[model samples]
Target: MSKSSFQGTTRRGFLAGTAALIGAPAFATQPLPVQEVEVSQGYDPLRPPPVPEPPVRHNISSFQAKHWQPYFSNLHNGAILVDTQSRALHFWSEDYESHMLFPSSVPLSDEMTRRGRTSVVRKVKGPSWSPTPSMKKRNPEWPDYIPPGPDNPLGTHALYLGWKYYRIHGTHDTRKIGRRSSNGCIGLYNEHIAKLFERAKVGTQVLLI
Candidate 1:
């Protein structure tokens, strides 16, 4: 659940304090966007840093990431590793690798190369894409909101990440799998995203590493 924080100071105090003297907000007030972030990618099990800083179209000066953890997310066993830098998502154990390994998927079209790559974070069931204002501006053809369903850009399942506007989610465009595509969202096989979406939870740590 979310909380609220407040500083018991007034604008008068704000003007009186030095630039650095501003009071810190109360910690108890609101839920931190990343209440708990841990290293999940095998790259550095002890500590995983943010992944390749992917680029986007029609960028924004700032994005609102009030970041409320969803009711469910793509929470994974720490042993599983996901590297956004390599664009590969891996699952491993103490001894060996899982039979299935997800290689870095990049789009082949020039349209895809326009932006960089990203990682998979949380997964959602029947996700609905509430296209951002920028998304609508870029793709005027886009819908105001994509209702949760099979045909949605978010597909039957979605693996959301902490990117500006990117997510490695399920796609109705199955043919785009294993290739560079999408405005920014990573495309996964519908079946795969669906299966994985069932296993995650909100607050699960997601590493772009």
Candidate 2:
């Protein structure tokens, strides 16, 4: 199959076929904390500003695979494992015995989702969107800046990876969670990304394979 076709098929297939994969329980042992913040304007040359939504409960377990048998022993505790082939992201517990694996969407093909070992360089809440140079070249109609809001592609939270311009972030559209739709960044459900943001700290090791 052609690379683009393979990517499109792989993303859909992984989401449909891997629902039973072992991981963390759908429900968390403890209640998630709540925080409130102000929204700010992002880059937008012509569009009106967007309206931000209040924080909501993150029922991540309902959409994630249960914690199952350990897989990568070489990885240290608190590491993140991105199985691009499986279209899933696994966050290891501090002991490395348990993990929470969330269904994910990757770049449409290998060229976009480059293999690498990196770390969480930074964390941004209500991150704004600025079209990358490549993005602008592909679609000149894209706005110069997008404010943080429901319409923002970055969703509620973003975990910036070590690679420049690459991130593990939330999506405004939940429907895209399991589809190969991004340029190269990892995409997760808004609630799932919020949950991950709370647990993932700067410098956390990330292995993308």
Candidate 3:
């Protein structure tokens, strides 16, 4: 005879009794309810999380050394190359011993841009500013003139070019550097301009490209 029959108890009945004896719940014999999880559309639980890309920096200008021989015949007084596309200025000393690269602000638009050769005709420390007739026509509300001071548009110093109404100058608004923010001028930082002013002569050769 089987053990269950000999004991006068069935196998299933014995197991249920044992479960109760062990303090197992009455519903322990029944199947568990299925759980529902809310997931977003197109989301795959098996997929690995995506990595984010690095942010692009727009404000920084690209600076590099350049050869003066390709651009100029000779570094007579000195040579200054203003690269509008790169928004940078390059300077080479007369003896070609010293070289400097400075971030600069170029013309705001193509219409305002004047390319080709020019020379530093005059340099003024604590320079005054006067908006051109074209600038005045464009912005009638702008001031006619600005005296040399902190409020001056041409900050600290100015290098007047051979071209009429064009200058390589310093700006009080430093944000203008490494950008296309000038009406028709190439702009530099006050400190950089001051250094350039010291090294550069009135006859410094300038080329805007």
Candidate 4:
């Protein structure tokens, strides 16, 4: 057969068939078997599965994953409260249960992309931090992986946000916390930040005053 004729049969035939099937009487074809759906915590098979959403990137660090165990290390258990004017962060025990992690104040900064100076920008679990252009230039010798241990420059754990590429994190540089001494990042004692890392969650309301 000629190419044109052949194309018509294949393409048109398929479309015709589709329309017929779709337009046929609802019961013209054999009835489909019906099954009941079982419910589960996070998934459902009976109904169409939900469309997945793209994941958001947090700028914390792998250093957060390994170094600190803040899951249960707070006076209030991993809740962050920041006083922007004072430049301090507080990690209190969560409301449900209780144990103070650290009540001592640590200076903070509003080096983020927010409109005005503020603290407690946002909270996330093990946030991810990508270095700023200037940071990479300054620390050209910085390593590929900020490793999951204490000595990592991201410190023991890191909560990174815009404020001039500043991160609220642990540091072997404990001396820097209550001071405005980061490349615009917040510096906490290596041990202290670790505690914050353990207790904080991805969306634990970060109150900034």
Candidate 5:
């Protein structure tokens, strides 16, 4: 072939190879089309998605588990710590293998509050209720006796403390838990107190703080 013809052929081959290299990347890197979701009835394509409402929060800053060592000299016959500040109860079995924490209702005010150490002298299931003289004096209309049942304020179980007129017991009214709503006793939910009753014995060491 002639030199001019040869040069023209070479230039055509170079241009074809360069074009293929450039076009290959453009096609290879192309993005896939996004599939459209099926719209339900009343759906608005122009409207933004709904924002969810924030979760409701309760005042439970100190509602956490605690170790059983600091408050008790020993875990003899099991130990219970009632934290009035946190509105919680901590229990540890005599063996120290079982530990449980529960929300509690403390006394309504300083006058009704009792702090210090005590022991469970009695455990009564379906305990009867009677307002103390002071309680009745404060509220004359209060009932003199409440039989063991749903209406009883002592709830399903009661762990009578060493101190008179004091007990760690259950309450049928769930709203009282995790608050200061009791007279002089530490109160737990009926279900929680039932469980604690099974774990605690007659001589369980108790401390209220």
Candidate 6:
């Protein structure tokens, strides 16, 4: 996409605001539209769950670097490599000579993105989210469940990895994509995850480094 494609007033403002909010608290005080729940924790049950700021759609494509890498051809077709140090993911494409690589930002977190080799085990569309046991222990106020939708933390699609509680999934908060923000799962832009969902299959190897 060209730089001019993102020059509209609303788009520019959103982009600027997103850049400013990096490193800010992920949660906002605004109340979510969902029903309320009571809790023992200090959190106000009435407060809305933190939703990510509206995504600057072209920000990833505009700011993250992507390029062809013939070296990726050495990997099996459809193999994925997550380079946490670079905050990028690489997939070896079937075509070796022409377009042999696909790259996208895959943000890492100190707590998440464990270094290991795993494979895609399953895939889901509009995946639902339930806070893991550790997450609930940290914040007892979290909802028992969040159905699939805009408010859901896992966006449009999910590719379950072999590891428990870890997956390659889309994020409700696009701002978190290129940052160290997840618990253990790899996150991608909603659109990028959707495209990846269509291409990746069960048993596809995934390497994190």
List all candidate RMSDs to the true structure.
18.5, 12.3, 31.4, 24.9, 27.5, 12.6
Kindly list the per-residue Cα lDDT of model 3 for residues 145-201, writing each as its tens digit: 878887787889999999999999977765566556778999887777888888889
User: For residues 45-100, could you state the per-residue lDDT of candidate 5 as single tens digits?
Assistant: 21122222122222444444455667887889989989898777878788766666
What number of clashing residue pairs does each candidate have, in the order they appear? 15, 7, 0, 32, 0, 1
CA deviation > 4 Å runs, candidate 5: 1-59
Full ranking by lDDT: 3, 5, 2, 6, 1, 4
**Superposition-based RMSD of candidate 4 using all C-alpha atoms, in angstroms:** 24.9
**CA lDDT, every model vs. true structure:** 0.40, 0.63, 0.70, 0.39, 0.69, 0.57
In order of appearance, the predictions have TM-scores of: 0.47, 0.66, 0.71, 0.42, 0.71, 0.62
- Residue 189 lDDT (model 6): 66
Over 4 Å off, model 6: 1-77, 94-109
Best lDDT among the predictions, by candidate number = 3
Q: List model 6 lDDT by residue over 1-209, tens digit each.
A: 32122221222443354345453322222321222111111221312322433433323322322232422334453667776765556554443321112223343345545887888999999999988898888778889898888777777899999989888887656556544656677777676677677767887778887
Against the true structure, candidate 6 has what lDDT?
0.57
Better of 2 and 6 by TM-score: 2
Candidate 4 structure, TM-score to reference: 0.42
TM-score of 6: 0.62
Checking candidate 3 for backbone clashes, the offending pairs are none
lDDT of 2 by residue, 119-167 (tens): 8999999999988998898889988888898778888999998899999
* Runs with alpha carbons beyond 4 Å of true place in candidate 1: 1-76, 79-88, 93-99, 103-122, 199-209
lDDT of 3: 0.70
Q: For residues 1-209, could you state the per-residue lDDT of candidate 1 as single tens digits? A: 11111111223432343122223332122322322111111221111222333322211111111111231133234222343333444332222212122323343334433342233456567787777675677667656775776447666776676565666676654334333445555554555555445444433344433
